[model samples]
Target: MIDALVNGLVILMDPFRMLMLFAGVAIGITVGILPGLGGLMGMALVLPFLFGMDSYAGIAMLIGIAAAVPSADTFPSVLMGIPGSSGSQATIMDGYPLARKGQAARALSASFMASLIGGLIGAVALTALIPFARPLVLAFGSPELFMLTILGLSMVGVLSGSRPILGIIGAVAGLTLGMVGGAPVAPEYRFVFGELYLYDGFSLVILALGLFAIPEIIDLMAKGGSIAQRGPGLGGGWMEGVRDTLRNKWLVVRHSLFGVIIGAIPGMGSSIIDWLNYGYVVQTSKDRSQFGKGDIRGVIAPEAANNSREGGVLMPTLLFGVPGSSAMALFLGALLIFGIQPGPALLRDDLDLVFVIIWSLAIANVMGTVICLALSRPIARLTFVPFYFIAPVVLCIVILGAFQETRHWGDLVALLGFGLVGWLMKRIEMPRPPLLIGFILSGLAERYLWMSYNLYDWDWVYRPLVITIGALCIGLVIGGIWLKRRSAGSAATASDNDGQERLADNRAGEEAQKGAQS
Candidate 1:
């Protein structure tokens, strides 16, 4: 096994292969930073170039592009409060906050660092877990997946912060919106309102833009300033981000492991991993009030988990011939065209190829991180630009991204409509993360719920994992409510104590004055 890995390094280090790998990495970075165009599109674009190419070269380029994207996807997520990809939705929670505080470079640096560490850990895990990966994946059934969705839904309570009522309303609103296009379990459309665009429903890109980016842009315009309202600096600089990530090194390791396990399961993609990891971090941290407001650990947790998930994504694809994600699905097609099939047979017959892919992923992660770190400080300078100059361009970028979903006028209409709702939601101080998350998981949850119902006729409730997750879901909600009430009570107690102290001081001063007069 070690010998295979060593041979892969030797092959990857060859000058010609290294050049191809670097080119793919560059392409991946570009794809990631561009709104709505992510790893899936990147793999599709690289497919035609694989004809008659060496298997090592083709696979290296594919893995190179795949591995490099998560590193650069942080760019828009942080700098613009727009998710660079669906996977980056959670990143905007704190990453954009950091950028708004003039720490764009720091957030980007920490994200890249986390991605690098997580990617390496993921690759190592893939190598070590290949033997047991199948059983681990098969352990999860429809019931388990449904319970997972419920687990994901629990995040709304965590994210709602001090406003659980508003959060519940926001999540319910999102589920309604998510159900607009087509029914998950049936053929009925619930909220299309008779437009052709309504048939496909709102794209996730459109929702992300309208729900988050537009609101941030509107606020920037209203405030008449740069994103970094403080001043024109990158804050504590990139090294501070490095130190911040190092301080949370154990967090990176723990979440990376979780990422690998979660990623191995189908339908549990980066969306689930990123948010779940973020919620876990927030839930476990002692000092969490700073989370949505530019905390460094917020940047670390999601980035690490998402990057690590890329490795887990590959395990199922290679071992089970099941693509773990859209990008992996495209890459799976590329493998077929190249006469490579993924299965136990492939692993037995093509051990070197498997190692080569894994090694390429790790090496590309290093390359991607190095490239991002070198460019981060300069790239971070964009946040210092005045808002009026920046807003129109970003608005156009988001508009274009939204339009790409269907190339219809309706996409723009949906964008404007949702944008207004988002702006209003912000004005009311309602947290937006829970809404986005609820919308994302609602369809998935409904699908799995239906599946579980049909498969086991409610007997799935008796399953041990389902019961455990259900209990956890209940506990999660209860815990969030308890914390909210406890914190509120503590604040009230402190206020009362302060008032009593003031009254006592006033009485003492009056007595002293009377004594002096007497």
Candidate 2:
């Protein structure tokens, strides 16, 4: 095993292979900066060029693209309030707010640092777990997966902020939207309204861009200012961001591990890992006031998880030939093109290749982070550009992103519709994150529920993992409510103390006046 690891590293060190890896990282960064174009698109673009390339170099290039994207996508999410891809939607929660406060450099740097550390952690996990992960992967059956989806849904309460009812409404609305496509277990569709586009339901790109980006753009255009209200100077510089990540070191580790676990699950995609991490951090923190604002921790949590999941995603893809995501599916296809089958046989016969992948992922992450840090100052300056100057470009990019989802006119229609809905929700002070979370998880929940029911009837609920995860769901909800009440009670007590102090001061003044008159 040690020999294979060293050999893999040596192979990736060859000049041409290294150059291909660098090229992949550059392409990945470009794609990630454009809204909605993620690793999948980056991989697809490079696939044709790999036809007759050296197998090792080709694999290095693909791995580099995969590792770089989650890190690079942070650019749009932080600076413009746009989700560069589905994986980055959660970063907009606090990252864009930070940008508005002239902390774009801080946010961007922290995100890149967290991405670097998380990517390394994920690589370490992949290396350590590859030999022992088979049974762990098999442990999660349909019942367990359904419970996990429920666990994800339970986060809606925490994400809804001070308005639990509104949160519930938003989640339900999202579920309704997600259910519009073909039924998971049946042939019937719910809300197509006779349009063939509706038969496939809304694309995540359209939904995310409409909900987050369009509203911000509309408001910015109306408000007539740059994204950063404070102007060109970055209030918190790059070093501050690096400090913030280091300050929250344990947070980076926990969320990175969470990302890995979630990524390893076959059907769970990158869509919900960041949300889960965000919700967990909010739930566990004693001070929840800073979230959804410009809290650096918010930036850290999602960025860490977003990058780490790539390593976790490779687990099932390499071990069982089960692609965990669309990008992984592309990866599996590329493997087949190289005449390299993935599974137990590949593991036994080509362990060196597996290590090569690990090396590429780790190296790509380092390269991507260094490049992002070098570019952070210039890119972060975009926050100071006037909204009017920036709006048209952003609008064009967003529309193009949405249009590419299916290349149908309905994409534009849905983008406009959801944009209106998002604007209204923003006006009404309703939380949008819960809605996105609900939309992303609804299909998984329904599919798994049906699978569990058909396979085990009602008894699936009795499975140990199912019961365990269900307990976690209940605990999270109850704990969130309890923490909220505790925080409120503390505030009320502080207010009462202030009132009593003022009353005593007034009494003292009255006595002093009476004595002087006498």
Candidate 3:
């Protein structure tokens, strides 16, 4: 293993490969700084170049692009209250608050430092885990996969507030929509509704673009503003934040570890990992109450965890051929396009590629961090841009991304369809992540169950590992329900108490006024 890794490192020493690495990281930083253009879109746009290049160089560029995007994405989250990437959402809760309080530079610095450390940690983890990848891949089965999906769905509780019903409805809608193209068990068409375009049940990228990006743009236009406006005059020396980040190295380490573990688990992506880490920091810190309002550690934990998750997610992908999340699924496709099929053989036969991936991730992080740090001041001024220009450009980008998924008009129709759904879901307070997760995993779950039933003759359900995972899934679902009910009861009680207090004050004021009049 060490021999293979050393050889791989030597290969990366090529000036051309190094230059491509730097170029990818630089582009990734720019993409991350721009709202609505994320690593996935950037990679998709660049994928064509891979068709003409050496496999190593092609993969190297994509890896570099992926690594750098998260580093730059933190800037938008911290400075403009806009996520540079989906993974950076947790950073916005606290980071944006800090920026609003005139600490935009500080927030960006913390995010950059966190991304650097997290990326390095993730890269090292990928390298260390390479030897054991084969065995881990062999252990998982259909039942485990289904349980993992259920667990991922259980995170809706943490994501939604006050309207879990609406969230559940959106999730059900997504799951049903996911099933529309064909039956998972027998491959028979179901709900295509006589249209050839619906046979594939809507492209995942189109759905993602519609569900997340389009609605956000529409909402921005409806509100008549740009996120850039909120970020005005909020820039200065980021080095001070870097210094502050170094002082809190331990927090970053702990959060990175949290991210790595959560990310390693299949079905649990950065969304849950970030929120979970942020929640932990709030629970553990002395000044926990300062979290949502603007605490640096609060911002740092999520940024570190979000970046570190990329490493953790790649673990299963490189080893098992099973993706930890959607982004990794796209990466797996890229690997396949390069003639690398991920499985036990990759670990034994193509270990060099594995190491290259690891090292590339690290290099990308360093390059991306420096580039984004330098560009943050200018990017911060984007918040000052007028809404009229920003809205049209963002809408065009969203439509282009949606159209590119299948190169079909129906995808554009689907994009608009889901855009409306997204708008409605947002208005009703539905959590979007759960709906996205359901859309992603529903097909996988159904396929796995059918295989477990037919191939295993129902014995799969009785397997000890299956039983354990299933029970765990059930427990998570039950726990989610319990938390929801408990939260509702608390809110109900608070509402009642407030109403009573207001009525009492009103009566007392009336009585005093009558006495004065008499």
Candidate 4:
């Protein structure tokens, strides 16, 4: 393993791979700084370029882009309260609040540091797991995969905010939306309405844009204000944010690890990473009450998880030929075009390609951070842009991007349709992220559950790993319930106290009235 790593390191030392890595990171940061674009789009754009390139250089570009995306995406979330990608949406909940408090630089600093840590963790994991990667990949069968998706569902509780019921409803809605095409086991169509476009299933990109991007556009329009009035601070407050991350090192590590583990399983990606990390931070913090209220840790958790998941996701991709997320799957397809097969044999035959991936990721993270740091001021200035202009442009991007996935007019229709639904859901205080989460996991969970059942005839249910994972899922559900109850009790107690104070004031007023009458 050491020898292979050394050989891989030598391949990464070449100037061409390094340049591609730098370019990829730069492009990823640019994409991430945009309000609607994400690493997925960046990867898609670069996919064609990889068609006939050397395996190492091609993989370098993709790995670099993936590694840097989270670093840049956080800038918008922290500066303008807008998410550059769904992964950074979780950052907006806390990072933007901090920006409103004149701590945009600080928030960016924290976000960058956390992203760096996450990138390192993911890269190391990807590199180290290469030896036994094939077995680890194959060991995850239908039951384990289903359990993993269930774990992702645990994030719904966190997305629900103060309303768990609405969260659940949102989740169910997501599941229904996910089931728009054909059934997993059987070959029958369910909700196509006889449209040819629906036969291939609704595009994940289209749904993502509608569910995540549209809601932000509406909120930005409704608010009629930018996130902050001031431009980025030239002061060294960004360094203070870095200091804050160091202060909470353990939290960053935990969240990054959470992202890696969840991301290692195919079908669970950035959306789950953000919400899962958010939920974990809220549940375990010493001052749990401070979450969602401009807490730096809140920003750090999602930022770390969002970045780290990139690496964790690459594990299954390079090792097992199982793409961890949609972008990675695309990367794998690009590899196949180049006659490069992914898996254990690739490791032995083309260790150089493996090194290129690892080093490219490391180098990309550094380059992305530098680019973000340089552009922080200009990007932060967007907060002063008029809300009206920002609205139409963002809306157009959302619409166009959504339609790009399938090139069908119905997808455009669905985009507008889901936009309205998303807006109404927000009006009623629904947690939209969980609904998306539920939708993403629903297909995977249903498919795996049925496959496991048919294959094992219930014997798989008793497998120790499967049982343990199920128990953990049960515990997460119960834990969510317990937390909700506790929160309700606290709220009730606060209400009772306020009521008693009002009663006392009324009695005092009555006494004064009686004295005046006498």
Candidate 5:
């Protein structure tokens, strides 16, 4: 194992691979700073170009982009008041407020620094976990893996944000979408509707654009403002933000661990980790007043978590062929294209590729952080660009990018159809992440369930691991609801206390004035 890692590190250090990594980081940062396009689009954009590349080189580039995106996305969240991706949404809460107060550079710098540290720590943690990784997959038969899918379903409780029914509906919608093609074990098609395009189902690329990008394009163009609504204080806040990160070093480490832990859970690796970290920090802190009002800790926590999640995401992705997120789903596809299956066989034979993946993530995180820091000064200008101009180009890119995937007219129709649905979803706040998550898990769930029946009959339900995982899934659902309600109650109590204090102060002033007049 050590030898494989050393060889993988050597290959990553090769000049050609290093250059590709640099190129990928550059492209990732560019795409990440854009409001709607995120790392998923960046990876998809480059996917077609990786056909003839070596596995090491291809994975390096993809990891480079994947790791860099979270680091670079802070720019828009802090400066433009727009989340560069779902992962950065919590960032805008305090980061943009800091920018509004002329501290954009501080926010951006701290975010990048936290991202770098968190990513490095996550990579190291994954390295430590790799030796034990095989046992986890080996222990899980079809029953256990199927229970894992149900555990994934439990995450919808946490991700839905006060709308569990909507979350369930969105997940069902994804499962429906996943069912469009032929059944996993049967030859007959279910929802093909006689269209060849429906046979293979919608390409993930088209779904990404329609669900994530098109809605943002429509919103950006409609808003039609400079990306940054306020002047940024980039003049001297870089060092200050660095100092802030240093002061809050433990906070970054704690949240980074949270990111990794949550990420390792089957369906919990989505951007929800970012908000979870932020919320955790806010709830535990002695002084909670500054959380949503330009606090530097806000910038640090989410940045650390989002970046660390990428490394943790690779664990399940490599060991069980289960993707932690939609972006990772694409990664699984890319691996298959390279003739590498991602489960036990790959672990036994292509161990070096896993090491290569680890090295790429670590190096890319460092390189991406450096690149973002260097470009921070110039990219601040992006926040001043008019959305009207940016919108048209992004729309064209999404439409054209969809076509580039399958080179078919049906892709266009799917793009428009899902685009409208996505826009409506945003309006109603239906939580689009569940749709993607469920879609990714649906096929795995079906196959695993079928295999469980064939392998163990109905007795699979009594298996120890299956029962344990199932119980955990139930706990997650109950725990998520309890946590949400408790947090809401705490926040309400605080608000009421503040209101009562203000009322008391007002009455005191009135009584004092009356006494003086008497």
Candidate 6:
């Protein structure tokens, strides 16, 4: 195994392979910076070019693209409140707020640093776990997977913050939208209303762009100022952001591992990994006030998780020929195109190739981070540019992105409809993250629930993993409630103390004035 590892490293070091890797990283970053163009698109564009390329170099280039995307996508999410892709959606919660506070440099740097560390950790974990992961992967049956989806939905409560009812309503709305298309188990559609577009359901790109991007654009244009409302300069330096990530080292490690575990699940895509991590951090923290208002920890958690999950998703794709997520599905196809069979025999015959992938992922992360850091100074300047100047370009890009979903007119209509809904929700101060989370998980939950029933009927509920996950879900709810109440109590006590102190100060001022008059 060590010899194969060394040989793989040696192969990756070849000049042409390194150049291809760099080229892939550049393409990945470019696509990631553009809203709605993710690693999947980049992968599709590069697929045909790999027809007769060296197998090692081709795969290296693909790995480089995958590794760079999660890090690069943070640019749009932080600077403009636009989700560069689904993976960076959670980052916008805190990151964009920080940008508005003139801390764009800080937010961008911290996210890049976390991505670098998380990518390295994921590579190490993948290297260590691949040999022993087969049994663990097989342990999660349909019942257990169903429970996991429920676990993800439970986060809606924590994400909703002070408005639990609104959160629940939003989640229901999202579930309804998710059910609009053809049923997984049944032959009929649920809410199409005879519209052919409804048969395919809403694209995630359109939903996300409409919900978050359009609302922000409208608000910015209406307000008529720069994205950084506070000032013309970045209030904090890049080193400060680096320090923030270092200060939250444990958070980076914890969520990166969480991302790895979630990514290993076949149907659990990148869409919900960051949300789960964000909700978990909020639930566990003692002080929950600064989260959506630009806490650096929020930036660290999701950025770390999104980058690390790339390595985890590869576990199933390589070991079982089961693609863990959509991007991995493309990767699996690429492997087949290269005439390299995945699964057990591939491991036995081509272990060296596996190590090459690990090497490429780790190195690409480093290259991506350094490049982002170098670009942060200039890119961060976007926040200081007036919204009027930036709005037209952003609006055009967003429209283009939404249209690409299906190249159908329905995409634009949905975009406008959801954009209005999102604007209303924002005006009302309703939480939007829960709705996105619910929509992403709804289809998976339905599929898994039916599968469990078909396989074991009522008996599946008694499975140990199912019971364990259910208990964990219950615990999360109770714990979130407890933490929220404690935070409220503390705030009340602090307010009372301040009131008493002000009263005493007023009395002292009166006594002093009376003495002077006398």
Total clashing pairs for each candidate: 0, 0, 2, 0, 0, 0
Taking every candidate in turn, the Cα RMSD to the unseen true structure, in Å, is 10.6, 9.9, 7.3, 8.4, 4.9, 9.2
Q: TM-scores of all models? A: 0.58, 0.59, 0.72, 0.62, 0.84, 0.59
The residue-level lDDT of candidate 5 at 350 comes to 79
Which segments of model 3 are wrong by more than 4 Å? 3-70, 73-107, 130-133, 142-172, 182-187, 230-238, 262-302, 315-357, 404-406, 475-518
User: Global lDDT of each model?
Assistant: 0.75, 0.78, 0.71, 0.72, 0.79, 0.78
Q: Please give the distance, in angstroms, between residue 310's alpha carbon in candidate 1 and its true position after superposition.
A: 0.7
In model 2, pairs of residues that clash are none
Whole-model lDDT for model 4 versus the true structure?
0.72
lDDT of 5 by residue, 1-518 (tens): 99989988988888888888888888788778877777877886676567778877888898898998898888888877777877887787788778878888888889999999999988988888878877666767788878877766666756677787898899889878888888997787988889988888766667767877778788877877766565644765788888898899999899998888777765553456776777788788999777776789978998999999987888777876766666786687678668786766567787888888999999999999888888777876775677788777767767877787678899899999988998999899897767876776787788889999998889999998888887887886777666556545544543454466558779999999999999
For candidate 5, the TM-score is 0.84
Candidate 5 global CA lDDT score? 0.79
Model 1 local distance difference test score = 0.75
The alpha-carbon lDDT assigned to residue 81 of candidate 3 equals: 71
Highest lDDT model number: 5
Task: State in Å the error of residue 299, model 2.
Answer: 0.7
Cα deviation in Å at residue 274, candidate 2?
A: 1.2
Per-residue CA lDDT of model 1 for 1-518, tens digit only, reads 67777888888787878887888898788767755556765664555456777878888898989988888888878887777776787788788778887888789888999999999999999989766654554566778777766665564655566676787778788777778888989979887788777887666666766776677667767878544433334566888888888988999999889888777654354655777777778778999667777788888998999999989988866875545654665566567657885545466677778888898899999999998888766554543456688668767777776676668888789889888988898789897666766675567678889999998998999999789868877875676455445534533443354356558779999999999999
User: Of 1 and 5, which scores higher on lDDT?
Assistant: 5
Lowest summed lDDT over 10 consecutive residues: which window, candidate 6?
Answer: 489-498
lDDT of 6 by residue, 1-518 (tens): 78988998999999999999999898788767755557865665576567789999999998989999999889888877777787887788788779888898899899999999999988998899866854554567778767766765665675566787898788788777888889978998888899999998766657766777778778868977554433334466799999999999999999999888877654354656776777777778999777777888988998999999998888866775545565665576578668886655467688899999999999999999998898766654543556688678768877876776678999899999989998899899897756665665677678889999999988999998889878977886676666545545543443454356558779999999999999
